[model samples]
Target: MTLYLCFCLAMALFSGPGAILALAPENEVPLHPTTWLGENKVTPVHLPKGRTRRLYFTLKKRADLMSVTVSPCAVPIEWSLAVRTLKDKPPKKPHWSSKKSMPEVWWRGSAREVRIYSYTGNDVDTYTGPVYAPASIYILRLKSNEQNTKVSAYIHEGPGPSGAFPELPSDPKVHILGVGMTSVTLSWSPSSSVVVKDGHHGSLPYHEYCVLVNHKHNYQSLCAAREGIRKERQNVQKRERREKPGKEIVWATLKDWWWQQPDALEDHASSLWDNPEDPGCVCRDVESVCTVSDLLPETQYYFDVFVVDRVNGTNAAYTGTFARTHKEARQAVTSLREGQVKWVTLSGDASSQKGEQLFRFKPRGWQQNGLLTLHTCNGTSKVKVTISSKGQVLSSEEVGHQLAQIWLHGGPSYRLQIQALVQSSSSSSISKGDSNKSKFCLKMQASSAYHRRAAPVFPATLQIKSFNKLRTCNSITIAWMGTEERSLYCVYRRQIPPDAKDIRHSSTDRCLDPEARPANERVLCKYFQELNPRRAVTTAVIGGLDPGVVYVFDVYLMRRWGLPIKYHSKMVRTRNEC
Candidate 1:
């Protein structure tokens, strides 16, 4: 997900940046468990008569977890949310096995706020999982964990543009549900809500959902049911006096162009459905326009919806995103500096966005707070390595991808901690980063392709068996059993050749063909076999020749059949006591 900015520089150069313009101020929002405090918001669905909406509230910081408990124990039902394992890259995948790792358990949690839908006697809604990070797509599940209640489920991406305005589904129409006065429900399947992009790009990608409301009246304006399943299209379109607006798709490859002056303005104001469509008489404007109808009137309601975007042309697939909204609007983001490695004591109103987020801390020319972005790859990881003045990582090698250390002229000789505030998975991971690990590099992407899986599945174990040394002279003999979680083990021989000094290149080619014995060494036998999916394979490697020389060797398992990629095992030395 990219950075969501408010308006523009004019908003910041004049009004100022920092906590004042935060959508969710440091004190108003839940503090992030692993990061510093900042802003957050729900998707919008603004209508002309903005009467019904949820109240916007904030927590101390971001919480690693937030539990939802429905009241009135008598109510019975089940609610579950599932995050796709295929979506976010997995953490681990063993090489050579050629199998993708699935999510922790397919789904994460099952539960929702009390307002989603209601339950009658003999029915209890049971939530079965945990909440997820923002912008993450998830499927909702409502089942009879206790039996008796019947309500559809859905996939929510938090909420987005549609949540603030209503529009007709271009293709397959959606079915919505209205719980109580304030609870909005939608039809859903246990399956994934957003259409996943299989591979490359070219096909139009868009997400779709059908919301099943509590009452048909909440969406249908027809005085009566017209047909059995398909409802007649609602007539709310009025002939346009001028040319139609929104004739073109607003292309925004770089987020910087989203709110850029004239470009975004055309799409934001010029685009227009200018009318209502099937089922609901909800009007469509360039921005948004939605409202609540008669359904358990006067009851507090919570509305959520998905915001769809098209990539390619007609045959495009579906991309998922959902958001929720409340009646109260929070302050817009002013200016911010998500780039500082430490609590930059220096300052300025540098730059800020209008309605969303993004606060740039650019310095004119020679200010102490030079402009820089403190980027990170695994915002959830608590590891960091310091970079030296010469650009070398001084701490652990895996702490960071690229590191850069900071130096102070006369300040305390201690490490300064600065949380990303906006990107950390939790405030804790963010805090763990705000350190002096003696040195550190600015956030950078990791280059190790070995760590690309969702869950890192490492080779479970290693087994080595020994053999008796050959009693002959000139060369000693050795043997051992070997096994690996992966395929193709590479055998290496490391021993100085007798004429090595005379050989300018020092011909110690460790990759001596396993089938052929070297002129400088001998091989009894060497070969690799496939490992069992349920278990590893065992093979023996017999050594020959070489009497008084000791040779140390290692086994490198292949993650891929022919790729240079490999994970090695501990060294094994051959005995030369013949």
Candidate 2:
């Protein structure tokens, strides 16, 4: 019986109280020599029932306290842990009740047996404040509930290599594949080596690539703008300090003021891709090639590439180079007198006695002349050309196999009609003696011309209060304040033209027929709706729009005698259809 008792005692001592079993072995342990938690020194402490103990450690550099684990002595015990960063001075003994008043507390929870607490920015339960970068002195408070407990505390550090882990690989090679007016395509070779942190190889499979773009040509302007913003912020801060003599400045107040600046610095930089499947910016085929779009034209841009290890919370040095996108090609509108050629085909069957074709031309700028070349379907047939502007004939000519070139001096609007006459033998005419009557078809092509008009007085500006996206896709609600009473307001909406030159030319056409119905359903505009002018606040819901199309809306107030006075214009793009 004594021998059996000795065996039991030996087993108890071997597997029980002083066994040195790791309570939470999976918890991350710091590996860097400089890390405060890397010392591996165990502080054994005894806490009475319902009592708390606080321990302090100072971080010399910026680091992330990833996790905390507790190894209980012999019996399972209920315990709670909390961490707070001491900014100014360490507080007196802090209890669970005073956790909220601490500068920044990370974890607060109770558990039985071994416990491991991990840190996450989104800690919705206890802390509702911004998760700041870990630095300075940290206080770890441990509490025991209804049971006396002896435990060894272990804190984990992140952002450093541990064990035989390797450092981050060298920067990747980035190359500009192509650069367009509004986009830049970049290709890069992936890092050959892995990044090591927390005594383990980085777990994140994807490396983040950041593309930084700056207008090299406008570098001076950008620097000036940045300086101006800095001065403006400084002036505002000085004014606030003067107004509130000794009041403490809060970070939230300054953050709000910084965001309110029209030219915020953050606007200049953008991420290459926010996520793996970002639609706007595409990183295609093994993620080696990234295409960044929605850039400006005729601008010189300098691009820099950065590789980031997000899981390790570290970034590689920027590998930078500069490239300029080709300037946007301007559309050249050659006038008719300058030998601009445009073709309009007028064709008819043999039974038709006459064929006519109407040509409409809207000039770019200033008054000019147009040239018309009439091509006969039959080489032997003679054709008559008649060009008119606003119901007045500008020219008349006749020619045979040789092309009929007619010079026309017309106003902005022109309509040209052509007539063809074919001489026929009596046998072919079905009348034995008729020679002048015959079946013929005519085709005429007219070149474009430039015309000038006097600029008219524009109407009073219409103040648009707000244009907001609706909950439903493909719709936007616009609200505007009216100035003149009893003014009939017409709202015109159209899709934005793809070409810049088309924008200049279409602006005139959009104004001419703001109420014209569109022939194609795909066309969003040529849309017009009249709003009641008696109301002070004018609001309208523009709907039936094609998804992902940019549209421009023009509000015109009708004057006396039905003349539309251009008022307000705005551009908006509809959301993509889900």
Candidate 3:
């Protein structure tokens, strides 16, 4: 666990609602300036088991209505809120009012939001008391059972705004600039709204825009995020129950039942809010062009451009746009004749160079191995070449002027994709018939002799000393300290029996020794090349392993010139079935 998580757990244990209120008088966890209720505030309250917390706010003379909303963060907490009006001030000790305890409300998932409103309006039918005065104070007392959770309390003391949303800006076209295997670049037009000047010399825009991007997810309000998550989980649960007719899986929302779940499960359920990079506003405050990267290939994504009222937090979302990224092409582009080499050139025009150009080569049965080379023919733009087979990338290299070589594995067919890294200066000069634009050449030649297997060189800077592995019943997570040097890392797994004893004493170098190597080893996965190279640590998640099996994992660091250096991890046994 990280220190940050430990600190949060410690705070949750000792913190209380009154303690938090003393820290931030104006709701410690404030929402945006403008929302549906127009600057309504919220506080994160932690109530201990069988405890009551009292909160109050003064009502101004201009306001005749008071609204207080409580939303439990998790579980169906048996909670209640009592409300009463005081002429002068709130009592030091809170006494129960006329409001009854809230009823049992059930939601599909623990992360769903449930709202309970204690509203007091002048024309409300339930109210029997005289009209509330301007200087009156409203005191609220909240009580909950044995559950630790954070609840948002929205308090507003004035006439609510019209239920209708504000007008949205025109010309909301989201252009798909370019798309890659794992990323997409998007741009949109900037919008302007009416300005509201304050009593002083400065003024602010009454409306602004926020750009939200996600994989097949769209939201119009804060509550929509949680609602969408709940509906998705509910559908999955329904399908699972249908598959297992004998099993009874109740969607329990009780506080007592919720505590029975493992802490890891709850943490995983709530990770959507904790992940800073999760689907959210990529651009705000009127910025136009934005790039939403790190997306999964062959998946559709929704981009929403919402017009937000800066003064009152009302959102007018334009009809969202959806685009699906390109998947790996299945058919081979052309056949590679044995003992013959062919050169293919890619032009720099926007039409030809917008995305990755995939070229597949099918070598004849006689050809066992081949060499693939790439180099720039003209212009200053470089290119990235990746060779893959059966959707797995064997090697990837970026080259500029000099030739770059990558050995292709023995296969029936392999795919080579070239992506031109055209500079911004040269993009403006590209034309349909221009010959001076960026150009590159690709050459694949069949080779008779296999590359020589050289002894591995363990560089002091790139050597792996220690690493950590987290094991579940069916998966393992391997993480190791990273180095500044850019390289490729691949993981391979081999299963051994539980009774094996001499495996630990076996020579690790036998992996590279052709005669002594084990044939059961198979590739699992690799570290993504798109991640930051200078990161402090690199992690890979390997799934789909048999439970109750002992496995050995090996990592190979591929060198540019010599053979790869193999690093062995401590043997790990997956947990037995529950």
Candidate 4:
């Protein structure tokens, strides 16, 4: 400012040598008398450097028809005025340009003479000086042409003249507060007014507002922004809701967001809507006591609510926000209790076939022995069964009419034991000569459900060959088979992967040890590359040992020793005795 003041002063007067001083004689040939003439000389109007400076234009409602002249400082240079109409009709597409700028609302031109006057004639400064001389420049000079500058023509900004909005029925006030995450809380307080002194024709205007976020910075009127949001919302038929016991005198308006195109939903930062009369189009406001069940999971939305009266389409009072719905949580199971029979997909067949595992068990609170157990009723084809771990299955089982009793070692703890229920032990209990089928009484459980727990102590492993007695006596060989990786194994002298292991890939290990070794002992025996599974391994005793001395044998294995059975195939005999 000080720099411009110094330049302007230098322009209209001179402080050079021989310049007429303030005490100079009247008309005594002044040194710079040519620059000074009248009391009010031309000087530059001080303005900011940029042309698009923030400017605010305010208007007051005048009851009578009179005119007022607002004195707006002429843009310093290289700037012009652009006027956008704020009418409530169709949405004019938003636009911008480098050449065609903001409209010129008022310009100095040949408009019916004597009404308005401003600088014209284009001529560049002849003096090539660094400093600007106000009197030498165009437009910059305060008083360029003749008469004490003609007053800008009067504009009757009265209530009703030519181009005036019909009287507003309400005193509309809107508040815009930006919320985080590109959201905002918009609120408005409005009171309706009457159009005529006695009749009911006032603009019962609904206070609608679009954020126009990051849009025109110096918009002069609130009504202009309100109408912009309202006009666009009408096309979409968006609904506006009310908060509570208040009368819906006004329609809810949408949050006006700036966009190049209207159809795309992605880039939109705010939700625009109208009040009911426009129902169900937008989400209901949470403040209005809406139910959670009414919403779907993972939905996106925004809301606008207002009052509607016959007198007023929508009350100016309105509010809105953005929100989403939550998803449903996992469901719980009922009916089935703990310790039930479950079918082990591979309880007995884990080793017969070589392939990847088939199924999985989601362990529940009381799950033990995850094998699929069927009814051990009278009409059943029984097979030798084995098991290792419990508590892995996570779902309940389907109960059937037939009675099934797992060779479960009944104890408080779901532990492992070596035994099998009689009825469930044979393929079919029929006499070979007489062909007589037999039936037996057994205890059956009603129902069961998935429960995760420690594998309860149960009869899983027993070491004996085919049940029928054989004629000749030879060498006794033993082999252990089962994963030594994690499960308990026994020596199944002439056995393979059980029905469950072969199918489910369970960690159930069946061993053929003469004696059921304690869980703490290493069941693994020695491994030989040539020893094939289910192949007999013979050990000869020079002198026949006592006819039936149960001999426990040990072989090297990979299970901290060797994998039993196929890997640990070898034989041992009772102390030799003639």
Candidate 5:
């Protein structure tokens, strides 16, 4: 029994990073009986930074297990907890650099809410059988990080007052109940082993499940992957510029340029669709049946069902399947000659709140750009116009009473979708059946000359101008001039390595939160802002830097869909004196 307890203690002590402790002789202190039949006392504790707090308790009567619940207050904290008995030693200060020591159970985590440590279960979301022993005294030792944290502690007896951990849940079977334009309905059977006694007093047996929906489309992923490859190749080229011959380097550069063309990249992406990788975790719900909404239209999705045990917070994977949502409208061809404008009238039906009209355009030896315009002709309603090709939406706009225009690029074939919103109207001119319906006028024209417009189109050259005068030792300002009015800019910064004397930045680095990376290359600051109409140039400041350190800052222009474009980058050094 002692050996088994020691083994479980070692397992728990070495579970997390920087968890090391040497047990000492038990220190006698005032003891309180842990609550079993009644509510456990909630003792609020305020722990100073780099300090320790201990509470001693005794089990009224030992059965199978005991649980200690530490609920945090408003502040987030990095803390570790260790429980000891009279036979075992008390927890001493942990030597975080070593992993040789052991304790009855030690847990370390950063949390802003509740954290429960079970004496019976192995701390990492599983129950490895109980290794608990009866003791006259139990000690709770807590250590905090640099933050002065506050928490409430509750010690209880038994596997849990709520319920004991059940067996691993059976895998679930998932099926598509229904699918719509922007949503997918899924249903799955309950796991046989998921029944656990969970209620106000642990008297009810209930089943719990988690339904996961993952977006299976790879269009955006393909673009991001290509961008990464392009950046890596550019880096290699820069590194080999002097070592390699001029002729070979020129030819290699030309090949790289050719591969970057849209047609070539599309073809490459198509070839990779045979065996696509699953990008997990789009949406999830704690129900057997779920309807995921606000999804992309006419896209592929994957569904998963997991049998979960609420007591121990363990999940058993069941089943998953792929499903594609219905398209917005059916396909039909519309022929338009060069320099020709065609107009069509659409009638909204009262029976349906929304209506869709789809037309396919295959240009032959025509101009690369097309113009589409829409306006409500009769009744009060709004319309949404969408243009797509190869399952990729290029442009979509919502038009009300005024005329709206959308420009399209040249392609082998394109799909046009016009969706009308039917509004209720009591006008006498409208028929009774079509009383809630409306009429819209749609005009389509093809010509290179129509490309001339007042404002610059999006995805235009995004260039970063000079920085503003807001430079300081700890922060630097980034200034950029944009051609489009409504644009989102994202900036990222990383410390330059000392070995990199002649450094060049990777333009394809993903725009992610600094907290996502480890301490080495983590971004210390983030800046995201939309373009201000009143100002001609936009500027953002990045702070939190050490003096005498060189950092590289990259600016990217975010788009509504697909990957962002890397606009520019700069290298700045902080003032050493600061």
Candidate 6:
């Protein structure tokens, strides 16, 4: 009896408290009974050789188990452990063993003692298992030889209270808010549940969101396959019942086989649905909004959003949406031929002029604001132009390289005045020689009509020979010669009182008070009269001048549609009434 007692004590000491002996009627030995949260007990399970017995256990909430120990009460029992989430369904049975296999199974060798460890916290000895996801069904598939075996599973809880598990995060809701030519904006609702960590009572917020955008082609393939099936069915029904029995049946079968082939459809769909080298844009540590750019314009795109709990390295189900990018806008033409162009001579005359020649020409058909291109016909000259419309000067500047761009408003008549300083030997000779003998001529051209026909040029040069007042105190007579016999002439006169202000003097330099100056200095009081300069010397009389007042007179050589090429100005004091 003493020897028997000593032998039993020796066996107990060798096995120790952490180990369980394989015997009939399997029993679970809990290492830490105080930390025990849950246990799944399986009774005697009989399996054929090379067959597997899968045990499924669903987690009610998030759980961080310290260790999962599976012990076979019978010595000959061999087992393996595997786990899979609810989102990932268990693959079909006769499963092949590979690195890419789902429900990764770790086979514990056929031994009397088998233990798997998962440690939580900073404890070096703590063994930890895979983080069990909440609401996720996990399968602990065990396989063995042909034998009747009993198995028991002990799940050791970590630091938290027993049976207290966090629920899995809710699925995200995705929406495509806006689509641009090369970009798309997306927004989604964050998951409601937080990630539960080991030894912590509270949960951590979702840390990141993964987004995927792909071109949907599987749907198109499915639609086409259905249509092909429908057409094939109709064709089969239309065949006559009296057709050759075996031959017709064989032909119909061949036709049906052609319609059911999935190779072509699958290949087409695969080309479109393949994932890009760089996966879709990911929003790290983000909650809701994300914008993706560099997308193809006018193309359809599919989207998926995943709520991830970075603390636990777990994610929720995918949320999907789709959108199409906008098309690009067309550009406008900028050529002058296809558009309107206005030509105005702002400065130098058609002929060379000495010193400075200042003139203004209001081009016709100046409807819209556009570029102004200038051309220098003669020697190099500096030209400045001032653009004025509706009595307002819009711009005044020196044009560079004889080219200037100006903007003009519609519905208003614009006048462009060009001042050019030209250095020419002929102009200098004309200015230095006898003034009566020298003649200056200028030619002006109108803009082409609808930019189709060449502009018509008109002579605007005229020379005045003599000017004198008649016996009448209110009348005067003048004689002038023009280059063209058919040219017309206009004469203008304005009265100036002795007290009239001199407009040539600057307002700041004038000694008189502001009110003393004439309100209108540049006004022409005499009506313009047209004269036909048909003869070598033409005479015209102006009959409506104020007596005893200083008057300014101007004679202009006119063109049909352009400004005067040459003009003469003279001041005369009329004789007082007798």
Number of colliding residue pairs in each model: 110, 3, 4, 89, 2, 9
TM-score of 1: 0.19
Q: Residue 513 in candidate 1 has what lDDT?
A: 29
**Judged by TM-score, which candidate is best?**
3
What stretches of model 6 exceed 4 Å from their correct place? 1-173, 178-185, 193-453, 458-543, 547-578
Between candidates 2 and 3, the one scoring higher on lDDT is 3
Write down the RMSD of candidate 3 (Cα, Å): 29.4
lDDT by candidate, in order shown: 0.29, 0.45, 0.50, 0.28, 0.50, 0.44
Candidates 1 and 2 compared by TM-score, better number: 2
Q: How close to the true structure is residue 217 of candidate 4, measured as C-alpha lDDT?
A: 29
**Can you write out model 3's per-residue Cα lDDT over 417-448, one digit (the tens) per residue?**
77765557544555547565545444434333
Candidate 6 lDDT trough over 10 residues, lowest sum: 117-126
RMSD in angstroms, all models? 35.1, 30.0, 29.4, 23.6, 33.4, 24.2
lDDT of 6 at 496: 58
Model 5 per-residue lDDT tens digits across residues 314-423: 23444567788888854455655554545656666624533566666554445545555443543355777788988899878877744355666746667887776555
Give me the overall lDDT of model 1: 0.29
lDDT of 4 by residue, 267-319 (tens): 22134321213221222211222211223345444433332222212122233
Off by over 4 Å in 5: 1-55, 62-135, 142-156, 159-161, 164-180, 186-287, 296-333, 338-578
Better of 2 and 4 by lDDT: 2
Badly placed stretches (over 4 Å) of model 2 are: 1-173, 193-206, 212-279, 284-286, 331-335, 338-578
- Candidate 3: where are CA atoms >4 Å away? 1-46, 56-66, 69-139, 143-195, 198-296, 300-332, 337-343, 348-578
Instruction: Give the higher-lDDT candidate: 1 or 2.
Output: 2
Model 3, backbone clash pairs (residues 3+ apart or across chains), number? 4
Per-residue lDDT tens digits for candidate 1, residues 1-578, read: 12334444445656655534564442232323221112232122221221211222122334444322111111233443334323444334433243322222222222222233333322112232334544333333333343232221211122232121123345422234433343333432222324544667654334332221222222221101111012212221222223377554322211101111112123432432122123232212122223334333443322222222222100111121122323433333223323322222111111212211222222222222221223223323223223222233222222232222222111111122232222334433234454432122223211112222221233444333334443343433333333433345554555645553443333232222233434343322234443553444444444453665434444444333111212222223344453
- Can you list the residue pairs that collide in candidate 3? 34-312, 34-313, 35-312, 35-313
Candidate 4 segments exceeding 4 Å error: 1-524, 531-578
